[model samples]
Target: MDKQIGYGRWKAPADVMARAMARMRERERAGGPRKAVIGSGKEALAEAIRRYPNDPLRQLAMFLDASPLPALIGRAREVSAKTRTNHGDMLRGAIGDLKAINMKVQRLDQLNRRQVMALAAYWTHEKGQTPGTVANKLSALRKFFTQVGRQDVVPKREALYEALAVTGVSQQMVTRQQVALDTKAWTPKGVVPLEVIEEVRETYPHEALLMELMLAWGLRVSEALGLRPHSSDTPNFLLVHRETKGGRWRKVPYMKDAQKAAYQRDVLNRCRQWAEKSRRLEMGYPKLTLQQARSRLYNVMAEIGVTLEQRGVVCHGLRHEFAGDMFFDITRHRPPSENGADSDWYKQNKTLVADAYQQVSEALGHWRREISSAYLGSPTKMSKAQRERMEQSMQLIAGNPDVKQGLVAAGVEQFWITGPAADGVLLRAGEAMQVAGRFQEGWTAENLKQVHEVLRAGVARPIQFVVSLEAQPQGETLEIFLDR
Candidate 1:
């Protein structure tokens, strides 16, 4: 039996040492049992168990017992040297040019623990060694021991060389509200008033008109920059087809007087100048790089004493303004209702209003109603007076007998108007003549047939019609025929 103390200064009895040696020998013969080593520290244990499973105590005792200390020391020295070559080489090379300045591993071993710590401190503080560098060096040292054939001395671990990261104190995240256009976020504040538009027009006469267009239309800087003279020739409509931020192509329309004028003159001139000066391309082909135009616009605004913190308006703001104004107008002019139903023109002409929204969506290149509604904000309730007016309009359109006769004269095959007619009757029209084009045109046989189909379909808003002498010259009443 061998008498030896374990690594942690624990002494093993002679009998225990004998048993451990036997187990170590068994491990060597059969190889390490799967359970002997597991988890992170298992690898080194596995190797040791595999090498001397049956004689583990004898092997372990060699390190602990002074009688066998000389032999164990020699073995350790050999293993350490081998490890130094492989792991140490890799780590030394990783330091790159710094290797020349550092002591070799052999020298490192001669230094005391305090000396080693001081050296590490110097590398970090003086040389600015990054965490990654420390991690790499640690990995190399661990690898060296395992590779040097002294695997028994090394601990088995998966994350043995991983750096312990220092975490900073964290606080709760608080969201900040967005600042306005004229806020410090933007360079030029108050750049979008009418006066600024006038200044741009006067200063850059060639591009003056186009600046006005941008002020009126909520176009992107790039779209405005790309304006050409030919754009003015295409009626009052502006065709916008371009690739935006997410690399998606969109086609929308710009329909405003200011937009039309700006594109014709000022915008065209600048585009022409860019073509001639920068790209040396044909002046007839108008296009601007996305960055340059935005920069130019900001510079102009700055020169005009626009502050970044207030009133900075971008081309996109124009769209918001337009949508906001339109939404207000529609709500303001809405007629009233007679029934208890709170009168809202949108509610009254739900389908037609929906159609109008759809048209706007198409114009804005939006695929959803909710997205379009951003400009409308939340709907407001109407007053009783407004409701009464809506009811009157509904009744007038509902009870017009002239409409029914007209539908008949126009040869309407079949038509229907849901709910009660002007006289509080349901299914007002049996068959009516079609009304072609605008309601202003006189009804024809074709017109009467179309009107019949329209009524049958059940429109959102009631159609308006005036009584004709040929049909019936009397008090207005909605005339509708329901066929059994």
Candidate 2:
């Protein structure tokens, strides 16, 4: 029976949903072991059958009878598609003699996108799937789908690529690994100013230290919350070991003054409380879970005028900053972007960003050298002289009194012209917004709307302005550029 006779929705045949349910029920009638796992799996499988408009038996058989490699690969692919990590080995371990292929496909096809994405999230977040496991599964699935010749089974390759394209996966699996390697790195560092931490502290004193630790050390909120005085007794270092992402152990060495202070005082106190509550003094870490710490940190970071624009200032920014700082230190005296050439660390370490690429690789914990090498390339860096010239140009532009008055007088009107820098002054103007005559033609309402869209998407956070006011005299010559 054609499931999609009229409507697009697939309505399963009568036996499709009932097949698994019937089998489970028969097992129950025979006084089989009543296990929650079996029940849940059956229920889920049955539900999938009911939702999909296909023959379950035929699909399961098709999946089961294929050679071990293809079958293992196909199942692994399904797992990877459902979870964004690698689990080829686990998939192999879970594989059993295929008595039914048609049934498996029927059940799998019945699964909705939400179900698939959830399973994927759990696999990576809960089960700790490796990149290799994920890659093999993806490879297996690609082969299975290509061989199967089902339009529905053939996934959106682009989306699959996006989901599986971890830093190194592209290099090994995809044909355009080199091209992908050429792209700029998006390390997990934020660009929050050092002063912003002090400002946030003045407003919310309690969270000030926490904010500083996150920005300075790049410790995840959970790790920060679970900090301990006893475990972190080192004068210049704090030891961190937390179970996140499937109970994996990640140890971070902390070396910031703010972090050291927090460890001695507030953080140590919290750890004692947690230890008492859990009735375990063996591990003297704070009891606060990562989720709790992350939430509080998010709110605090937001209040401190932190935006995504400063790429190395967010919670994850600390690690990126650490890596970047090391990179700068290693290559400071040498000319820029010479990762592949002879240098101090490269000379001694016998490593090049283009060759061994050890710095970024070790920082990122990537398994492959190719993954770390991706960070070695940078097309955005300007020459030192060019950078100085750009700074001078900005100063020259900033020095013009008319430009300043125009920016200030226009207030909010000038905001769309210059983004957040003009926001504070514009807000003060309120209804008295007055844009300069020069902007009368350029700063149209349509243009402002477009600018807002660009600002919102480009910055990855809300806008903030540092406004300034100054005195200006009449008959001041205004030199306005057409670009403005």
Candidate 3:
């Protein structure tokens, strides 16, 4: 965990890199998840309950605790500490609320449907939790029941929505726009306010380290704590924790420029000091073991009123801050989450936007490039008013040489608007076609089945990008079928 620090730039060591390679060879030989399937997480949960009795965090850390599983559902392993804490809190809160009203729920199976809806009602009415918050709490509780092999105990989301008088969010949460609309709680997708972090640091340094790691590397709470000595062995990139999502180890390179790179190295070096033998995120004496470290990390933050549940300033937002910063660093343009570029910016630079999306996706350790949409919004987040204006702009000057050059450069081309056609207008950017104002309503999905059926026909790849969200391209407002 120790690095030679004297003040100059830190370079990746040769012997350390060799040692890491050796470890990699050993790991590859060992294979992934060679351990037998064994019993379900329920078995581990029982053992946890026995050992920790009163500690709900430790109890869930048994097997249902990796940085994956029920939360992501087959995407990653582990129930995150934040998630574990929420599940515990939600379940206990619900049970206590039930008991207060003469209902009983001592065991997992005893949590009834009515009790679940009642809790939802109380959260919305009495406590005044937003639909998103209530929904997340219910989901966490449902995960507890699901992981225990007793999913039926809790009512479904439909019932919860009906009782709570709200709508269900997507399983794959598109939170970028939602965060923008949020009034009270804020997203750190852009700049993480330093003052808020300093306030946290003034209170708890240990917790600050975890938050700092997430800010620096865009790591999950579990991933941030799983930092190791070998994590920073590479010269260019730092190896993210091995036990990452889906057990896949990601190599996120050090920060791009010199100054930021030095700060990143500093963060990793300090974090590695906390890494211990066979324990994830071991800082000093008491902060040993994943559960202990994780619990302390979150518990302290909650105390400081910086948790997402608390709607505090510096919760899981640091990761989003990293995303926004990394995107700007790579693309030189702020992300939509940062309120940087509207859909038109993306429309003008599809290729550039795609490349930036790919890089940010890799930086965020996502195999699916589009998944970055969760953190960064889709390219076509142009508002109706914005689209109307762009549509009018395009209509006013469809054959302008400048627009033609810009659109063609991105492979999302707009044809000459000054052409006449039997149908609507004769167009020939990549392929010859007639686009009239009549069927523009057909451009629904991304021209990816969301748009006109005619344009989608006979083309494996979308030839045109739809710039307007409303597909109001009378002349040529499209040239953005996001192909990242």
Candidate 4:
């Protein structure tokens, strides 16, 4: 017993510690040891518990005694470091609210779903947070709780929705109210007109150059500020390697037109000067935070007598203008319904438009082509010419004996084909054909069969078909039956 007690209290080997613990348990189970022996064993056990509390039982007891918010905050910090997000700030904000409310939530298990919902409600209604902001906060809290193994505190999705509804912040509710409230006509702001651009140039020369970089290259403000002349592989282009929002690198040329090459050269020299000045002043590279740049731009605009309504043109608006100009230059056709272009013109040029948008999207460092709308606006509706071409394509497909037989066998009664453009075709159930699918640009009979199977299986979205075509004319031929 004395040997075992000594092993327990001292910095002993692992085997010795194990033997000491086993013997102590055995002695206690058999009967109380002699008083002198028991006293020493109890002291050793206490010391062992303090030194190595790695047992599951000990951990449980510690968790039971731990305060909920601080433990969650600590766990959130660990998670944020791993994820490289701002989760710590979000968690701290919640804790700040809890402290303000004087809630006596001390234990990890003290927070129930109701309390969580109430807190979310407070942020939504009382704090007047947007539904999206509240949603993000709730999501962060859920992740934090899950990480800490306190998932019981996380509210159910339904319960959260209920809380949002009570606060009059449901997506549908907000969207409806917004639509009803937008009574007056409002043009999208930030499309810098030429006059406005000229005014900015004369007023703030340095800022105007930065604005021109964004306008011409579709560069983000951060991308412009992080530019280094050393990053240029050639005299006329620079490789952008900064951590973009899309997490990609792209090459930005100085200018497409040789006439503007001198201007581009001048801009590059000025950017180098700015970077050096920033380094000398120790004010940070590019010398401005995004907010500071925006504020300076706003001040310049104000000095030029641009109204709040006309102030829609910002750095991002310049990027949008770049995208729009690129689209027009590539397609040589405006979006359908814009500038009085008929549906036929749009349909004929759908592929060109899609290709142009995709090129712009890649240049802008965005992975999704759909995101182009934020800059380019919604795609124009299909033109009459496009409808006619689609109809012609469908007629050709129906004329193919194998394709027609397959369609009949698959119970497809009526269908209308839309495009084999840059994106793909939109095949909907027409007056006679009962099929719904979006076939790829080069779909075949097998692909059509797959679409038939998916529709039969009750897939709601348009089934994607992969078919091949041979030497179809740019906007006239519908030679889709030929395999690639």
**Pick by TM-score: which candidate is best?**
3
Instruction: List, residue by residue over 1-484, the lDDT tens digit for candidate 1.
Output: 5655322222335576455446434433442212211132334434444555554333222212211111111111123344434543544443332333463232211223232233344445556666555444544434333333333332223222121111110111111111121111111222344565567667764344444444444444565555432322123343443322212223334433454445444543454454444243222223645566667666665665553233444435455544433332334331111111233545676765555455444445344454444443322322433334335544443465655455555554334322223322122133122222223255455664566464545433435333243343233333334222
Q: Rank the candidates by lDDT, best first.
A: 3, 4, 1, 2
Candidate 2: tens digits of C-alpha lDDT, residues 390-443:
343334334455544444344223322232112211111112222222233434
Off by over 4 Å in 3: 1-192, 229-231, 272-289, 308-314, 382-484
- lDDT scores of the candidates, listed in order: 0.38, 0.37, 0.54, 0.48
Output the worst ten-in-a-row residue range by lDDT, candidate 1.
Answer: 166-175
lDDT (Cα, tens digit) per residue for candidate 4, span 316-404: 55665666555555666443312224545656767776776677676676655755655554434334334554565455555555654
lDDT of 3: 0.54
The candidate that wins on lDDT is: 3
Ranking by TM-score: 3, 4, 2, 1
Q: How many residue pairs clash in each candidate at the backbone level?
A: 72, 38, 16, 20
Model 3 lDDT tens row, 110-180 = 45666766676666666766767766777766666665566666556454445444333333221123322
RMSD of each: 31.7, 19.9, 16.4, 22.5
Where is model 4 more than 4 Å wrong at Cα? 1-129, 138-198, 232-237, 242-249, 253-294, 306-312, 334-355, 380-484
- lDDT assessment of candidate 2: 0.37
